[model samples]
Target: MNDQPLDNLDGDRDHATAGSGHDGEDHLRAPAPRVDGYAPLRSYAAIGDGRTVALIAEDGRIDWYPTPDLHSPPAFAAVLDEEDGGQVDLAPVDEYRMRRAYVVGTNVLVTTFVTATGTVRVTDSLNTGVAGRLPWSELGRRVEGVEGEVSMAWRVAPGTMFGERSPWVEHSPHGPVLRAGCVTVAVPTLGEMTTVAQEQDISGVFTTSPGSRHLVGLAATHDEPVHVPVPEDVDAGIDRTIANWRVWSREFHYDGPWGKAVQRSALALKLLIQSATGSVAAAATTSLPESWAGGKNWDYRYSWHRDTAHTVDALFGFGLREETHAAISWTLRTLRNPDMQVFYELDGSEPRPPRELDLPGWRGVGPVVDGNPAARQLQLGVYGDVMGVVRTYVDHGHLLDAETARTLAALADAACDAWRRPDSGMWELPELRHYTTSKLGCWQALRCAAHLAEEGHLPASPDRWAAEAERIRAWVERECWSPELQAYVMYPGSDSLDTSILLHAHSGFDRTERMSTTIDALRRELGHGPHLYRYTGMREEEGAFVACGFWGVAALAQVGRTEEARQWMDELLETANDVGIWTEMIDPGTGEFLGNLPQALSHLALIEAATALGSGLEGR
Candidate 1:
């Protein structure tokens, strides 16, 4: 647990992920997914028009980003310390052949390198606020050539972390400004401070031809007040942030059937929602390790109240109820500080503890960690993740004003006086007990606080939360229903077989016969087929848990087993990652992407298994 040592500066980019020569112990070994040029968390590819997000990589190297948001600190970490983290590279000076996408309904990325003297493309985006976030975060990247004659060579390095800060280069009045504390960054095609190879780089070297565009922007500004950036006004703010994400994905109203993989997992959970603090980051890169799983490296940027309560109930089923009521008013105003923290720090406080970062992870699988001990673990499945987002924000009619109905009646009387204590459940796991999804998350938070206090809007004591939600559904079917390991076990005496009980069959608490024979006993004890593992032995401890493979495809589409839930959600979206993003573990036979990248609970469990395979499951 290296707390802080990562050196490599005085000339940055001297390569070899520069977290070098560490003898003070723990240079972290056993890392296999990568180690040298760091790129393969599914070869990156993520841009954002929301508040902040960037990943890049198929060799065009942005690596990982964080500056004006997403809990801002990282100013790029080379996807976890490639020569002291922070890179902007931009491909082609020779051999190339990339191919990204996104620019359709926008989060604007585009890639396309194809060298041997032609096609450049590039694109990327972060610029926005024609109607949403943009106080100055513009990333822009243009580069277009589209045929013969290509020769790019950019660098823009920033790098810092475990060393705390670096990148300095002020010139302002709209030019090279790249400070690094209250982060100022601007990169107007970076035409100076060149060292490259000795590396203090903001390098240059351009040369296009057919059509030629080459405008590389960067722009940051955490404490805001430093605009002036005008590479033609940040390429017209990346064409008005790609027309504000294609008018929010053409008024996104999901037409079902993997409609372009559910609008690219709803624009990768709308770039993990950082809009000033609608705080949704459950993945935008952090320590990135789960492969060779050492400290199982984590950071996931922060803000998790159970992945923003299942991403505001899958963006309120794509009707997009204002980022699920601004991530349920930023998770009930950060649990009013009396505790229930399970993740925070998109400025809502509570992180500051998890340290361990002398740096190596993301390719070395060390203990890179940043800040998260599950915010002092007590994850009683966040009371069914805050009553499944207050029962989908009061069944979409929305009216729990009075301080969100006194914080959902003090979280349904504190989940009915703590449903049989012993927490750290929903995989926060620190050895507390009773975890059958923390006793069905306090029996689905007193059955959703007795349906939000019988719709009278939470004044709740509702018959002592309906008799402690029927004594937590009869104490999780008498101590977590193991019946000799037929199913439900990861806790009461532990025969362990969880994937968080495959979402208690979409929380009807067992849909026909012990969660349908515990989904074939969790696909024969933590399946590796459609990738499962979130409990029982944890597959030598990591990969395969991409939202428990969409909660076993929404528990086989709410039990009717809809054609094995559409062939296990079409083989789990064919292990997404060239664009339709999905990471937080995979690689059960090289599907690759392990731990963190666009993972907001694996795209909110693939939009709740494509909205339970397009609903109509009579009362489910």
Candidate 2:
């Protein structure tokens, strides 16, 4: 209900006038600019309906939206390829200035455009049906006239499945329906509107006066018959969607120092949770670029086992038992594969083998990808991630089912055998090495398994787990520690340092002198003004990893540097875009977001960092 400023919410001044125009309103009539046919990642805000997410640019262009699911091939992929990739644009015809906010406490977005002639407000949402998600996906946009009269233009253009399939409009009894591959979309409009269906897009223009309203909706389905939405029903659905989000938000109770940021993070995470299967995707989009220099982009639309414990802890902090239970159950059910692949598809299947797309990437970055390559890699640390989550559930006075207990025991036994092997560490790099953090992860997993067995929640060899855990710790101390750098190396006998080791600070790893000293060393070697690269030597390759910066915050708090952690947390909070959504990385020098957006790890880390600081203060 509160109208937070679109800019300068933190008291910073914006030079651009709200609705200002140069040359007597001529310049203000220009459409929002795009560089090389793309908006800055920071300019996009996400709207979703539990199953899929759409990214709307500040300019009122929906540049990215996948069909039935977040991981499906996108219908509007202008975020990746502007020319061939399609977009849906609805903005004033004349020059205008805009400001937007998430209708306060909801993912529903309201953007107000101020033009020379008049002002209008656009409300955007992915409509949800009553009792949960609808059988099909619906995207609704409502426009209301605020004052005077404004001329507005709109278009609905679905893409070629990232240059894979061609889309065409089929005139049906229900109006114009777009078909691409197995996906079908219905375009519906109201309030004196008639659209022209072209080869690949549908567009129309309308004028709005004071107190007038217009509506546009896209109802779509993959591999199913599409339902054409009624404009009045779509308008009502938008309001209902807003209400649903607000109701969910009310249940999330957090009153910490960064309460607003944490709340926004929770809502962002909510969008990434797939309601159908309870799997939490790592992000909403694929191949958004981790570095403008290109070559590092990877699809993050799949769920990673490594994020299980963090997601559960973050959800638990807000008393969201539904999401917490969903994440735990999904992880347990998916890991039954026994291979424990690093990540899985939302439908609990192995990811499609990664393949290069024919389309150009965001900002001309090439080799756009469709799937993640790390799914097959050996990530030894997953043992800890899985066991740690189950242990947390058990510690909350919940008993694990017999099947889950047996799975945990098997995972613990696997960890004991795998601790000595060199594999991809937490970073999922290509190189296999005796990563110090991977060793620490195994040690943490065994410790959790031991505790679970003692509580009768897991059937396992507690004595063997305890003895092996100590041996792993001793091995890490003897081999992974670097006397030359006075810190834990990335791997045994390597000079590089990894911020991933910071995670163990919360895993009950050593908080004594050596670990504390490594924190300072990491800050000196890898830190960039409260941000951090993933590891040593990454500064030249990519931006600072957003999650690592938050991990540093949690690490500082856990290592007993509360004041320093608070200061770092404050600075890091400002790094997010105006709406508090984060991508995988941040360009430290430019302060622009990079990589797939609304990242689960980054938001989860923020929650963990905030909670750590709060708990640290209470213990004092």
lDDT of 2 at 131: 87
Model 2 worst lDDT window (10 residues): 12-21
**Backbone clash numbers for all candidates listed:** 3, 4
**Candidate 1 lDDT, 1-620, residue by residue in tens:** 10122222113111111111232223312222344777677767687756678877666778777877766778777777778877787777786656555655666776666666676676778788666777777787877776788888877778874568766776544445666667777677622223332233466777776776767787777776777576777876777777777777777786555556666677888888877778888888777777674777778788877788777777777787677887888888887788767787876788888778787766667878777777787877787787778788888898777877887788788788787788777777677777777878788878888877887888755788878888888887887888886788877777878877788788787788778788888888788888888877878877888888788878887878777777777777766655677778887887777877888787778778878876724334
lDDT of each: 0.73, 0.84
Give TM per candidate: 0.37, 0.95
In terms of lDDT, which candidate is strongest? Answer: 2
Cα lDDT tens digits for candidate 2, 93-186: 9888877767767888877788889988899999998888898999999999987889999998888888888999888887788888888999
Residue pair clashes in candidate 1: 17-83, 78-86, 585-595
Candidate 1 clash total? 3
